[model samples]
Target: MTVKTAEDRLHDVAIIGGGVVGCAMFRACVLAGARTVLLEKGGDLLEGASKANSAILHTGFDATPDTLEVTCMQRGYALYRDICENMNLSVMKTGAMVAAWSADDIACFPAIMDKAARNGVPVKQLDAQQARLREPALSKDVRGAVLVEEEHLIDPWSAPLAYARQAVENGGTHLCRARVESGVREGNVWRLDVAGKPAVRARVVINCAGNHGDLVEAIARPSPFTITPRKGQFVVFDKTASDLFRTIILPVPTALTKGVVVTRTVFGNVLVGPTAEPQTEREFPTVEHDALEKLREAAFRIIPALRDHDVTTAYAGLRPATQFSDYQIEALPTDGWITVGGIRSTGLTGALGIAEHVVGLYRAHFADPSPLANVVVPSMPNLVEERPRPWMQPERGPIVCHCERVTEHEIEAALTDRVLPAGTLGGLRRRTRCMMGRCQGFYCTRRVMELAQSHLPGLVSPTGKGRSDV
Candidate 1:
């Protein structure tokens, strides 16, 4: 397939950033029957904060009432329920809890309930005995918990991919590895200059550039906030530890962080930590030794059984924290651009809401709007953790990646994934769960690489088989 140059296409909308928010906006724009083109600086989708999240689908329980964050969360949660059903996305409806150990923490529940009420999130206050009965592994020191029954868990990798895939199938374009260096408004249109590709001309440009939103906005218009990368580290325990908690076990909020959380993932693994440390380096997300000790101590108090479980992996991600508490979204009518910045965390939970909000901004400026004649939802490859494996099928081919129960047939589908611009091993792992299990590719590294080499031509095989790189 020959890729078209920017000159060959004048998109109705060009969206910068291919993270969850950007993908969401792309899908929304396409659904509105616009010619949308998504440009990502990264090699693949969900490579930033979107990938390394805690996968908690927050229900706006703690957000400030009437704020854009809470409103988006309230709306996004409903949109997610529908999208998950139609697209067959894996969503584990395990409710969330804010566990309180200290007296001060317990005192905060009333205010938490007040906030939940304002946001329309139905929450209940639980006593110590009820909390303990619900999650037996919790510390005896725990006084009570605030439960948000609609809160849930999902696989971190798929929602954006699903949206982007649906967008592509609906006539949107995905321009991977295309970083917008600068953009300018020519008359009524915006000319976005990419790093290597031809300059893309669009009627309007939507900036959803995550951490680089500051830079993208500075290119054409004034940005409201400066993005600072706050590094967070986490530990993933194997599925053997999943039984410890039926819900997302969260600690009371602190001044700096949301506090450590111990939650079971949709993939059946138990996730803990996510110690927030504001840092300068966005690229280097190394888990600090002291941070790990702090997280371990927090875990020991939150769940004593954490000591018995073995850690499958430990990694880090940087949040695009900004000076503002609420999200900064503005319609740059003068520049034919829209800036979406300061969406630090919960981008996954509020992605579609943000998209709808941005599209409204775009429509206010771009006249003669076109609506889709028919809507189509694309079906993604089966990546649900609880679902049956391809190997379970009669006479299926060889089995690979035993730790994840991935079969050769599933891997072949990933190698030829129709949605991806480049069928990378990392993408394959996200799509088919090939090398992301407990061993961390220790056992299936060579075989997966060999399979990729045999299937995908000229694809450079990854070394060490680690999550990030060689």
Candidate 2:
């Protein structure tokens, strides 16, 4: 429960942004034996682009070969598997299938297979009959598919939370609502002006800002890339729809986007869509009714059985996409800054690997600190439906959210977490899966507010009577 303050001490590395990548960076830098600090602009971590995603742990089978993206993805995928069990994270190995519905899509199979082979990923060619045998719910019109064996699903929230928690437990500073407004380097040390806080001194600054990456990069030097936020909208069906499919259903790859995908989430619900539409808006990614309708139509076309199930909710996430197809990771030795940008859909899988690569960059260009001899590894609460939940145990407290079966004990634990407790309602939801089920927050908001009102700031109950609602 010890919280480190970034007061007068100079940090070896200061990471900007609190997205998944930033959390991973903080963990990497701290474990590398650096005095690290992470400054976030939001009320909680993952308030930006990392908050919403498909949660697919990609195998990089379709990534461009010999590229940084592929390398980072493969390494991240490996690192996640190595630490998942220790951190109590969950990985559902429900392999993916590139289902082809038309002759043109089937024609692209050879190139796809060649790319997978080049990337050293194992894939199988499944004929229509074979594909349907694996997933009987698949449409009979499916011509063929390429089965990607290593592609899987993961708890996107818990993975990053574990990373940040470990870093904080092992002597790292995590400051929320501390946005970096400007920076100036003097004698190999950078002095950063964080909004509403005293100046921070760091030997090196790493910008992991998701949507505001280019803007952060501009503070160091003229940014080489321009961030054009690409919006991806998705639909989540009720848990009953999870029975409609086993394998993740993917569409044929196009130049612009990955197209819509139909897959089951780790929380035992079916998911679909994520239409890649580019827009100028940076902060909020609003879900349009038309876009959501189109996504539902697309999902129905992919899995007709889904028509019988009700949709729980729909959401949209903004990706920090640049003009370049590959990741934009480079160390600016002269400016004492490093920029990690253009990480779009694969960020969840690439975050750990990206951390390793950035650590290498810091060692090669900046100071090479000794690695921590005793690294503290923290385990996260099991939010994955496949794992044992808190409510399943005998000593568990009363349930707060019946839809998700979230227990009062789990909510309290999340609210009082020592290293990084839930600072906002959204953070609490992500931490304990509370208010995220079919009923959303209708059944549990009052109880949750009662438990969290004192711990969280500016949190009021449904009764609009200030804090008296508690």
Candidate 3:
């Protein structure tokens, strides 16, 4: 609960953007015993592309071999496993099936397996019959599949919060509604001009702004690379349809894309679609009517039975992609500045690895060569067990959302949690399951909004009073 003064001007490192990468970097800095400041323009954390992703934990099974991305993903998967276990976060290792429907796709499987092996990912090829037995929902035309036992599904919302919470507990400052307008290096320190706030002086600044990475880099004039926002749209199927698949079913990759896939979320809901299309950074993800139809057609082709399942929601997320296929993490000549770009789709799975890499860069390039002391930061209690949903904790059993089985108590906790503050009802619904049901907040919006307003007063009116309805 310690808040730094606007004019205080103190921090070892300042991270712009509060997305998964930025939050992860903040956590890494904290763990490395560096005083860090995490700045976000959104009212709460994970409000950007991070919260709306497909939430699949990639295993680098198809990533280009011997690349920085592949290396990071492999290390990240192990790190995530440790963090998930320690924090009691929701993550399901349901495995993954990369199925081939045609001769060309089948031919590509061996190459993919080779690539995975080079990336140090364990994968085994399965015959068509074996694939069908593993995932009966798959189409009969399937030629074969590569079973990646390590790839998993995670609750995207919880993962970043876990990192942010751990960072805050470790004395890192997480400031929301604080946007960095521009920054520059003056002597040994980097001074940041935060929107509507006083300037902050820090020894180093890490650019982890996701879509706005280029803009942040532009603030200092020249940058190594530019970022382009690649949009991916997805459809969420009802939890009742969860039985359609036991593992994440993926389509063989083409030269341009990874194709569409079906997967079961940790919340027991089935997910489909994730059509990647190039788009503007200002444009938030939304399902195009054509995209939705294309997704349905592709999904039906993979699992004909999926055509019968009810789709609960459709959304999109923007991926910060660069011209390079591999990740770009390097220090700038202008003292105390680093850029983390080209995260692409593997970002979620590779976040921790990226953080660790950035920390090493700080030690090697930015910080002095003096040996740093290891500081032990206390971790937050696991909320997954203590505040389970009504269905999970039957004593509090009246379901508010029949489709998702979200409850009132869960909504209350989401609105009140310190680390992942739910400023709006939609935000609360994202954090908890309160209003993300088939009704789509029709039944619970009012109550959830009321609770959110009560818990986060200023947040309910992010634009002051004029746009109170937001």
Candidate 4:
């Protein structure tokens, strides 16, 4: 019989959350030669704000001038290609446009372009005729627009999954369903307790707990900031609307929201809405009919042709808004805990730079670090519309999920993939795009679950909290 250790070994750093930021922190620590461990309360990954996020890779053109968001967003945008290429994540370089439906919106173009320049993003100004010629689906009343040439659409869930996979393969540890209820420092080490699991001890603790970041910080020490949940609801149109545009159609941003946008996903589906409304219930991801109508109106005003397409699905995402506008990342004096909070909407675009920032804080805490060589990047199976299906090439087994073109081989890989196995339908969807198409898995859910049960026994149940343990 194999001997199991009585307790887990102490790590150099123990990150509290498994969201994008936390996974990025874990990857950074591993790259910087730190023995890091990531603890997520969920059974899988991306359970919070990261789950329902719009898949747009922002250009930070409209970020508030001279803040951490602008700096990190700029870096993230620039680093996007290199990172995605190494990890095999699909990214659509289909640029973006901020459409002006009114004279006021038209007047804001010059200022918007100026702000884009300040954020180190180049944008082009287009007149109404010029805009109409580019996208015939756009509304006839569009006066003018500002084109952000670098804005791209990416696979939103892939980055976190890839980062976590890299960290684990590179000697970092990941604990799913390991929630850190409390942490206390004894001498030079911080001990963290997880429900129904061994206590994880570390010399440094970093909190990347998304919307519950404040709660995670309170577990170790008092929180310096409060995270107010801001809900943004969105509607996705079927891939039949792919011709609507090859780029993102943005609106004049307000102080609080990015306004609703009609943008293409990497898989060719068009997404609309993301109506920003402040809410306190993090558990409720309910979509409002009124908000759905408002988002539809917004999409229709920009692209009238969008009205002809069927609404595939609608969902909501929460952003961690705080009293301060910029991100709150600081090392606390009490114990070795650093808080990463208030990342809001830009978290997806800024994931890499935020990792660097947290790594710098990690170095500041321990003071000794060594330069590490290039970490191996794992190649992911492409799920983009353009990529040929497994059945198209090899004689893979019968197709399982017809809605998204997911095949049996692909489903098996998702079920047994070493990086992050799919234990739930949601997790499987994120991995293989199963059950997310127009039919919404009505045709394939049962067949897929049957495959899951055969390949990944005891792990394929659909649940309210998803597959993640936290």
Q: Write the per-residue lDDT of candidate 4 for residues 112-227, one digit (tens) a residue.
A: 98888887778899999988888888899999889887788888888788888888888888887787887778998888888889888888888888888888888776788898
User: lDDT per prediction?
Assistant: 0.82, 0.92, 0.77, 0.81
Q: Which lDDT tens digits does candidate 2 get at residues 1-470?
A: 96645844689999999999999999999999999999998889998999999999999999999999999999999999999999999999999999999999999999999999999999999999999999988877899999998889999999998999999999999998888999899999999998899888999999999899999998899999999999999999999998788799999989989999999999999889799999999988999999999989888887888899999999999999999999999999988899999999999999999999999999999999999987888978899888789999999979999999999999998999878998788899999889989988888889988898878777775564454311
Q: List clash counts for every candidate, in order.
A: 0, 0, 0, 11
Error of 3 at 39 (Å): 0.5
The model with the greatest TM-score is: 2
State residue 365's C-alpha deviation in candidate 1, in Å: 2.3
The TM-score values for the models, in the order shown, are 0.94, 0.97, 0.92, 0.94
* Predicted structure 4, TM vs. truth: 0.94
- Per lDDT, what order, best first? 2, 1, 4, 3
Q: Which 10-residue window in model 1 sums to the lowest lDDT? A: 461-470
For residues 1-470, could you state the per-residue lDDT of candidate 1 as single tens digits?
Answer: 98876544888889999889999999999988888899987777776677688887888888888899888876887898888878878788888889998899999998889988988889999999999998888999989999888888877777888899889888889887788998778888788899888888898888888878888889875676888888889988888888877889888887677889888888878888798878777656898777877787788888998889888888898888998889988887777788888887789899989998888877887644687877778766566667765777887688888888888878877777666643456667777787789999999888888777755444555654334341
lDDT of 1: 0.82
Candidate 1 TM-score to native: 0.94
